[model samples]
Target: MLGAVVAVNLLDAGYAPYRGLFAVNIALVLGLWLVLPWSRGHRGRRLASPAFLVATFALGLTGSAGTHVPLTLLAIANVAFVFGMRMAAAILAGQAALMSAIPLAVGRPMADVLREVGFLVVFAAFVLGMVASVLRARQLAERVRELTVAQERGRMAAEMHDSIGHHLTVIKMGLENAERFRDRRPEAAWDEVRQAKELTAAALADARRWVRALRPLALDGHLGSAALERLADSFSGTGVAVSFDVTGTERLLGPDTELVLYRVLQEGLTNALRHAGARFVRGSLAFEKGKVVLVVADDGKGHGQGRGFGLSSLAERVEALGGTLSSGNAARGFELRAELPA
Candidate 1:
């Protein structure tokens, strides 16, 4: 609307009064208004040619001084801002070359005409700087998004391994007991049957916990004492004396941070049960030196039969949160330690 008004006002001023040229300016504004809506949710492509911009500016120069003021700069600025520096510079260079040659071709000196091209070069540089800044910001934001998603996937995988793996280890131990007492010790076989029944109950509980942890809505919330309780309950039937302790004031952490810590603890406990073969598993959380420290230790025989997923998953999860995981023999058994930025 504003461009159309400017076009009409220029025509009314009656300077050079090219009615046909003003009509084209009005059509350009209307055409742009229609085109802009179709470019929604995407970058707009530059379509205005150097010839079009030069012709529009030359036409406006013949209007009244008031109309020429806005038109002269507007055309150059439009081409400079939209199509980029090189194209804008090319347009200015072409205009300068044409203006200088036209006067020379008619046997005249046009030295002052080339000076106008300098202004276009400056405008193009300014627009290029702005475009560069915007592109840099976009790249930084995209990198952050990719890292966030990767952390989330690592957290979910650790959660699945801890819950399911803990129960399966117990079931494997129970079946081993049943096999040892199957023939000669029928009476002892009855005890193994009872252990299998308990293992099955634990497995069912584990399945429920796995489903709950995997739920999208549940994962969004803070993994507070409630999540810790779930870990302790999962180990109840395994005959390991499991203890959980929290010493912090329970401030809320970032979503990704909380999930990572939860998985670290979960996997550590499962590792104690499966690899350490510990009779005592203890978990503690505390705030120390401006950091959150979580430790899971077991008084079990570390380095038992085979490789375990628990400790490996725990390390991956803790590292994802910019934390470290350290494990070794802690006097009587195995220990897993994690430290996360608070």
Candidate 2:
């Protein structure tokens, strides 16, 4: 807009009388654009911005009725972006005085002096508003980028905890049991050692999945129901009676939805093995009109602690998808429930 306005003023008949000034203005414009744009970064901006203003002031002197006053718009915006609005406002005042001073001292009429100052004020106001809006939008975009990074970090952290942490816990227990029975029950000790070795291999695979930041490979071809059954069966060797049942007709679900169901069961069974000291855990996935609900309930005695990282990750994931997650003591036992759109 400033470029168009400045270009239109070149058509003024009065400026034709001073064609020599046109060449100087052209040189000034070329120099400013080439050597003093704000894209030079802050290191050079301190000196370049002021130099830009000085050249713009010289440009304003080339004509009357403040024909070149709008040229200061770029300099004002640059200073505002680098230094701040307070300094920009001061620069606006100085430009207004300087624009008015030239015409007034040259014996120009009061009307022309006011016109020069008025043009500077109007253009300054416009540039300041534009600069402010641009800054605000930039800040908001940066904030959103930061939040996205943090969310992904939290999700990845949870992935590492659930994917690898659960298996490690079971492996540790199995190893302890193997050591405990090494002398008393030789056959039982060998059996536990074998289970620990199997779990160690599974945990290594999960670690690879965590590094890649994806859903568990076990869910690659299996649907939600099959994945839950496999997860429950894995923990069956730990002396826990695990049961999984799906109500309503089974339907195909998105990968994300299936992953959520599988994670809930994995986390619940893990907590059962680690803290519940219970013998039974039941999981249910219900498909109804427009939505699916997954519930994992264990007959374990409730522990008041709920600060697990996996649960927090699940809460955020569920909330982002406009789903609901609720976990606490249920009528039967401890229950973790999640409902999402199908």
Candidate 3:
């Protein structure tokens, strides 16, 4: 509709109606073609589609260059085709140079035409820069997300290794003890058998906890003190001093913010325990100064010297919320601070 309005305005401004219609049609067709499935990842299809689009756009712009269709439009179409199609970039650049110089062919003043040419160069350069920036940002975000998922899986596996694997190792030791004393001390052997049974039960419980940790928790809308307390309680037996601090009174934080905040805390605490070698950890959440601040600190050795999944996942979650995560050695020890807008 906006394009149609612009086309009509151009016609009212003395450009021919046929030229206005042609320009509108070119814009509409290009928009539709860019949305096609083939445009997503298939390089070949992208190249062909944009080539046709640029060709049609060039025809329309060339037909009404000085009237309604500006020289910048020609440059823009060229740039779009250049980026969207692999080989088309150079082709469009050359085409734009030739077409923008067409005014010189028609006996027009070089100075007047040079003005549009200058604007075209600036506009094309700006668009190209914006496109490059957006593409780079998207690429970085994708890499972060990939690393986040990989880190989650690694954390889950480590938990399994620490819990279930440790239990299995203990059971093997108990079996060896019982076998050595089988004849000499049958009663002692019986005790080892019982110990193995107890170990099996504990291992099963660890397995359940591991599975629960993998499953996502459905958060309540209340976002109350009770919810935070329950989360703290779940980590009570993990040999870590876990705490929850809520400065602002409990109220319903919108679902998106609540979910992101919970995940951030979970990832941060998991990192402190698994990587920081800290026996005691503190988790705090406060709403102040028009922002929600979450801090997870540990008195253990700071973030490991190498990259890990926990930090990656935490960073991804923090960034997704338009927030930031800071990790450094606090006065007592290592600390992670995550801040998000309320």
Candidate 4:
């Protein structure tokens, strides 16, 4: 609409030379083609700001003596939409000064020039202010969306820790009792084994339910211990002897701390399986006086210079929980370790 108004005014006034009018028309058409969202090609999107600014200046200079200041004002408003308020203001001020000076240099009435420039300046300022407000609102909306997602994730993690972790704790206790009494009290041991099997089935059902609801779960306390045991068992079928050992008394840790430790073990074991090609893997979890420590090592090819996605994710998770993770070549293999406050 603005472009059409400016074009009609330029045609009616017929103040510019034919060549100057032609150049302005070409610039206007090209600028609009690049600036309009639907018409803008990928490369044109990148070049739109500079192209529009040049086109606006050309239109103002060519039609300096005509009653087409509206074209220049429209250009300033378009620039405000593309750039920040300060940049848009600077461009508008420069264009207004040049347009006003061109008319005065040609002996146009000073009062007329001042009136035209003042009108353009005021309208451009209003447009720039409106654009800035819209931009700020958009930024606030985006921040709200980010906070919403984080809250949902925290809630899901808590739910998973409560339900799944409780089930895993039951399974782990049942299995430990079964192992302790297998020879001395076979019947009691068998009962405990059956109960553990049932708990495992229940855990699987809970996992499916949570997955269907699109929720996240965190590893916590007994759940982390069970997960480490299961990870070791998985490698047993691959002809790789995996051993898991724990030192110090068992103690409960925060959900975040447990989850990070579990992830560190998981990533370490995965790297050993995929990259190390080891025949033996050793994993350990230790609860010390003031901290918890986890280590996974494999008698395989040593560590590489670059870390993969899993290792990088483990590092980030541990760091976020105020812990430290290290991975390097050990004397006889590769080792990954993590230490966290108790």
Candidate 5:
């Protein structure tokens, strides 16, 4: 649309001998615009390189004619808006130099040439500034979108850990208890087996809930203690006796902070039941003067050398929020602890 408007205005200004050249310049610009790939992907820029070359050729044609037409200005503005400010400025400077030299070489009066060059310079500056501002705004909007996506992914991960991990841990504990008591206490073993079956049914429901609520779940002023208690209750049928306690003044935490804390507890309890073969687990959340502290300890065999996938993920979550996480053998068992600033 812009190209057609500019071409008609330029043709109306009357350069009868250069009519064909003006038409060719317009064709080249239109062709470049048509062939340019405008997708938001890596290949878009690569594919658009040929269009840039076509734009350069169109600018050359406009300059060689030495007619007071705005074809070059149109090309420069389009390139700047599409490619970026730096490339646009470079093309503008080079085209200005070439256009100025053309009239001088033709023995046009110095004052007239200077006046034309001055007008081109002012116009190019205005176009460059406008294009630069637009590019900056585009970049900022893209960054915001990226951040929003990353945050959503983090939230879903936390929710998945809390929901799925709790159910799986309960099922595992139930099976383990059933196997251990089958020979000595058949009735108790049967009860554990029944509990495991119920947990599997509940797990299916929880899975749907997590899927339906992909958005971040708020603490709703409960902080994280209510969720922790629910997690502790799921382990009831298992031999593992789990306990949860909260200390210090309970205050609202940022969503990210609460998520990290919840995940740390979930992952810790999961590792305790699944890997450590722990019969007893104790978890605590303490809100201190300037920070919150979480500890999950299990009376099971401690880690020998390296961390597992769950611990690695937990560590990353804690560290990203400017917190510290440590896991090692305590006096009698394995312990995972995280401290985060409130």
Candidate 6:
């Protein structure tokens, strides 16, 4: 755009009597426009924006006066972007006054110069408005980028906490069970120790999968139901006797919904194995009218527990997707329920 403006001025200078002066003025304008933005690199002494504006005005005077308002407005535009609207307005106002002076000195009618001054004011207003809009759009784009990065980091943190946290919990429980039965039931204790090693291996594999992709390793190619089954089987040797039941015709839930439900089950099972000491865990995934409800109930000591960090994060995720999460002591024992739109 700057090139096009300078090209027009150079063509207009072609017919002017003081062509040499106009050519020098145009060179100064081009140099200042190109270098002003990178003035920090120049260190000590540098040509400022007013120098560019003055050169542009001088270039305009060497040709036709009012006809080259575009060149002046172009200088004002650069000021609006860099030095802001206040400086741009001051520059435009000053130039308008000088422009009127030149025409009046040449014996032109006062009314014509006034009209030209009015037009310059209007053009300056337009330039300021356009630049303001561009700046706002740039600000909004940068804000969105920042929000996207923060949300991704939060998601990764919650995912590791839920998936790997569950695996570690079960491994810990298995080791504790093995220690309790080491002498009295030597064979049974050996089985628990082996299960603990296997759980360790699975946890390591899941960690590898997490590094490769954000999605859970167990849910790699499985649908919602199969993923729940795989999650339940992870507790098989832990003696929790996890039961996964599905009701209503199975239908495809979007990835977000599926992942939220999976997290609910994971957190609930982890809580039961590590804290509740519950012998039975029943997980139910129900596909209803327009939503799905996943229920994880364990017959542990019925002590009502509030949302910990993992559950709080899950609740936030579900609520962001227009879902609800509820957990408390029910008649069965402790129950956690999450519902989301399918």
Question: Model 2 reaches what TM-score against the true structure?
Answer: 0.53
Q: Which tens-of-lDDT digit does each residue in 1-342 have in candidate 6?
A: 445544555576455576667677667777776766522234332446667777777765665433556766876776666666787778777877887898899999999989988988888788778878887886796796577447756876787787789989998998899899999998989999899899898787657544534447356677779988787776666667899999999998876677678778877886786668799999999989998999999999855557676677778888988999998888867999999988
Q: Please, what is the TM-score per model?
A: 0.42, 0.53, 0.53, 0.52, 0.50, 0.48
TM-score of structure candidate 1: 0.42
- Order the candidates by TM-score, highest first — what do you get? 3, 2, 4, 5, 6, 1
Better of 2 and 5 by lDDT: 2
Which 10-residue window in model 2 sums to the lowest lDDT?
208-217
Tell me how candidate 4 scores on lDDT. Answer: 0.70
Local lDDT at 277 for model 6: 74
Where does candidate 4 stray beyond 4 Å? 3-44, 61-71, 208-342
Compose the digit string of candidate 4's lDDT tens values, residues 184-293.
99999999999999989878765754553341223233365665676556556555688999899978787667657755665676567556879899999999998999
How big is the positional error of residue 107 in model 3, measured in Å on the Cα after superposition? 3.8
RMSD of 5: 14.4
As a TM-score, model 4 comes out at: 0.52
Top of the candidates by lDDT: 6
Ranking according to lDDT, highest score first:
6, 2, 5, 4, 3, 1
lDDT of each: 0.63, 0.73, 0.64, 0.70, 0.72, 0.76
Which regions of candidate 2 fall more than 4 Å away from where they truly are?
1-51, 62-65, 212-342
Per-residue lDDT over 124-224 for candidate 1, one digit per residue giving the tens place of the 0 to 100 score: 45654664565567568679758856765676667666656776787788678778888988778788778778877767765765554454323335266
Better of 3 and 5 by TM-score: 3
Q: Which residue pairs collide, candidate 5?
A: none
TM-score-superior candidate, 1 or 4: 4
Angstrom error of the Cα, residue 226, model 1: value is 28
What would the per-residue lDDT of candidate 2 be over residues 123-170, giving only the tens digit for each residue?
778889999898888789679657755876776676668767888999
